[model samples]
Target: MAHYKAADSKREQFRRYLEKSGVLDTLTKALLLTSKDVVLVALYEEPEKPNSALDFLKHHLGASAPENPEIEALRLEVAEMKEKYEAVLEENKKLKTKLAQYEPPQEEKRDE
Candidate 1:
């Protein structure tokens, strides 16, 4: 999910709102089309939960999948950081060695 841009991530929320609004209007139209004393009842009335079996499976299965794009992006970022860190450490070691070669030797003080 992190790999998705802010706009793409909000697509789901936008779609939900769109579907909800459409359903509300559609239901009113459908009710008008119905005959007298014919009550249209939904077994599951809540929009928060999945209305169909396919939606239910998709929700549960997608949660545990290993080949997620967001996880892969994080792994790549970590590897890039590790390479940069290692290169800096090597450069620091080389700089310290060069610095030591340019330094004057310490002179021992004689006892007065």
Candidate 2:
């Protein structure tokens, strides 16, 4: 039937679109699959169906995944460094203030 052919044509067009846009390649790479077709089949046959396919892929691909231990450790180290930097800045400010008391105040330049 013409209707069946039209539906098949639409599906084929969609497949081509997916292929041309590199979605197939990206999905395959993210899932670490040797074959891109397997990515499509996996998504289609996922046992615990997710509400959003994009979210499901993102969750699996580390977008919303748990932080890696090394990365978490680096984050904490950065925070500690920032705290140290702030403390040093405050100490520098106090030292400058104390030095200012021991130094002569310069005369302000008056604009004529």
Best candidate, TM-score: 2
lDDT tens digits, residue span 19-51, model 1: 664543444444343421121222132346444
**Steric clash count of candidate 1:** 0
Give the 10-residue window scoring lowest on summed lDDT in candidate 2: 103-112
Per-residue alpha-carbon lDDT of candidate 2 for residues 14-90, written as tens digits (9 for 90 to 100): 56755665566667666566443554556556665445555645555557878899999999999999999999999
Candidate 1 C-alpha error for residue 112, in Å = 15
The TM-score of candidate 1 is 0.37
